[model samples]
Target: MEFRYLGNSGLKISEIIYGNWLTHGSQVENDTATECVHAALDAGITTFDTADAYANTVAEQVLGDALKNQRRASLEIFTKVYWPTGPKGHNDVGLSRKHILESIDGSLQRLGTDYVDLYQAHRYDHETPLEETMQAFADVVRSGKALYIGVSEWTADQLRAGHALAKELNVQLISNQPQYSMLWRVIEKQVVPTSGELGISQIVWSPVAQGVLTGKYRPGQQAPEGSRAADTKGGADAIRGFLRDEVLTAVQGLQPIADELGITMAQLAVAWVLQNQNVSGAIVGASRPEQVRSNAAAAGIRLSGDIMGRIDEAVGDVAQTDPALTASPARRPA
Candidate 1:
């Protein structure tokens, strides 16, 4: 698999990163997770992304176990902080210094690794001072707990603030993980450009718009029995409302291009995202080994300029309907 430098950082991540969001701790068992990881590694996927909050912190433990017995030196591990991982208490959540410190130790224990290649803040924390958050991350990096630091779902203004704070404090902010996809171009206006200017790479999540671009959830039909949309709470309702028949009809128009390329619609959708230069890696969340194989194969399917244009026009500046939304391009900070 071809590797790309995450923005300007010297560290290189696989073009397709295996993300364990919903599948690792829910749909897939320990053995299945191990099988998927092995399948991904065979396909040249070296990077793995997970969060402490996903599956009540079980995703991290499951992912850690999947690779704990393997050669840890051969893998690039990435995990996120923020979100509540403790019993009902406000102090257990947010990006406060206390949570940051405690969270890393827990993550390290669960990941079965001394250090994560990249540690990311899952979201912004208005309650904590930017300086405090940056300082805590700097300490983690200095203490060798994490190799690099990143932020996710944070606005450009917050990104700029954190970047400037890190600069003043002599800490490096390596990347920003956001929901960037063909259907969700919000990052284009500010987050992408801002992070680019700051020399921060983007490890984009949900590059496929949660399977909408793959044309899996048809407009009128019930979601396929075992799809993510069906498993996720309110997922079917959300998709049915946002992904209308017009969108499906438009999606159908792109099938011919995918056919000509000898790739599935999911591959075409993933390939379309990696076509952009700023994207460091596309996080592919797969429940089954076959899905992982399909996504990994997408790394080689390059869409020509004409097909790219067709994809753009087909989707037509659609807004993301995912509940955990990211910054919107139209409302991006100036």
Candidate 2:
């Protein structure tokens, strides 16, 4: 597998990071999850990303059990905080010092590891002071619970503020995890430039637009059976926005491009995201082992400028490029 340094940091992660967002401990059985993790490792994927809020905090335990036999030093494990993981309480969420401090211990315990290679803020906590958040992250690093810090789905302005404080606190803020895909260009306009300038690389999620880019959901028809859009517990709600006729038709137009490249629509989609120089990795989630192997093949493929242009022409109109779309949710769940 191809590897890249996460931002300007010395830590190297696989270009295709195997992530368990909706599958682990929820959608897939434990044995199935273990098989997928093995498939990823067999395909040379060393980076794994999960979150404390995923599957109500059970995903980490599943991933930890799956990787228990592997050599810990060879893997780049990443997890996130923020979002309510336990019982609903006012202080159970946000990036406050109490939450950050308490969350790390729970995350470490669940992951079966003393430390995570990178710890991220799942979202910008509008209710918490930025200083307190960064300082808490600094404490996480100093305590050796996390080696580096990252943030997910944060706006460029929020990233800049947190990055500045990270510098003051002498902690490394090396990566940003955002929902970036051929169809979702929300991060390209502002977040990408800001992160590039601040030495932060993007580990993009949903590179296939939650399977919409795979051409499995045809226009003028119901979603295929057992697909993400059809799976209520998986991504039905998240995939709805991209299910419009104009968007699906545009996505269908990319079949010729994928055929010409001799790659699956999903591979084409993942490779399209990695073409950006600022993207360090593209996170792919899977319920089946073969899916992991197929996505991993896209790791080192380089798309020519001509192919990229063709892609842009295909989905440019339907793509969500508005910078305002990068804003964090107004009301986070407690």
Candidate 3:
């Protein structure tokens, strides 16, 4: 698998990172989740990303169980905070000093690792002081609970302020995880430029727009049984925004490009995100082992300029590129 340094740090991560966001504990069975994780490992993936808020923290437990036997030194495991995890208590979320300190221990225990390679703030905590948050992260690094720090879905201004605080506190804020794909380009204008200047790389999620770019959801037909849109749990809600007929039809246009490259539409979608130099990895989650293996093939893919233009044209104006579209909760999620 191809690897790239996260941000300007010397630590390298696989181009394709296995993530268990929607599938680990909610959508897929435990045994199937383990199989998918194993498939990722077999495909040469060394990076894994999860969030403690996923499935109310059960995702972390399942992911930990899946990776329990692997050599810890060889893998880059990442998890995040900032979302209400347990009982939705006020103290159960946010980036306050108390929460950060307590959350790390719970995360470490659930992950079955003494330290995570990277620990991220799942969102910008508008209710807390930046100084308090960064200092807590710095302490996490000093305590050897996390080797580096990251943030997810944070805007450019948030990243800049956080990066400055991290520098002052002597912590490495190396990565930003965002939803980036051929159809979701919100990070391109503001986030990417600011991150480029700050030396922070993006480990993007939903590279296939939560399977919308896989060409599986057609324009007129019902969402196929067992598809993400068909699943009423969280997937349906998460993927609802991109379920328009125009978007689906636009996605259908990209199949010919995938056919030309002899790659699946999913692989093409993942590769499209990696084409950006600032993207260190594309996080792929799977409900099945074959999905993991197939998507991992996106690693090291090089799409030509002509193909890129074709993809842009194929998707047309259906892609969302508004910088203002990037956001986090105004208050901690309840």
Among all windows of 10 consecutive residues in model 1, the one with the lowest summed lDDT is 325-334
Q: State the lDDT of candidate 2 residue by residue for 1-334, as single tens digits.
A: 9999998899999999999999999889999999999999999999999999999899999999999989999999999998897895888888899999999999999999999999999999888888989999999999999999999999999989989999999999999999999899989899999999999999999999999999999889998887889888957987899999999999998999999989999999999999999999999999899999999999899999999999999996899999898867676575
The TM-score of candidate 3 is 0.99
Against the true structure, whose TM-score is highest?
Answer: 3
Clashing pairs in 2: none
Per-residue error for 71 in candidate 3, Å, reads 0.3
> Where does model 1 exceed 4 Å of error?
232-242, 317-334
lDDT of 3 at 133: 95
Q: Quote the positional error of residue 50 for candidate 2 in Å.
A: 0.3
Q: How many clashes in each candidate?
A: 1, 0, 0
RMSD to the true structure for each prediction, in A, is: 3.8, 0.9, 0.6
Candidates 1 and 2 compared by lDDT, better number: 2
lDDT of 3 by residue, 239-330 (tens): 99999999999999999999999999999999999999999999999999999999999998999999999999999999999998889889
Candidate 1 structure, TM-score to reference: 0.92
Model 1, residue 187: what's the lDDT? 76
Model 1 lDDT per residue over 235-277, tens place: 4543453467776667777788788888888888888878877
Residue 251 displacement in candidate 3 (angstroms):
0.6
lDDT of all predictions? 0.81, 0.94, 0.95
Instruction: Rank by lDDT, highest first.
Output: 3, 2, 1
Q: Which pairs, if any, clash in model 3?
A: none
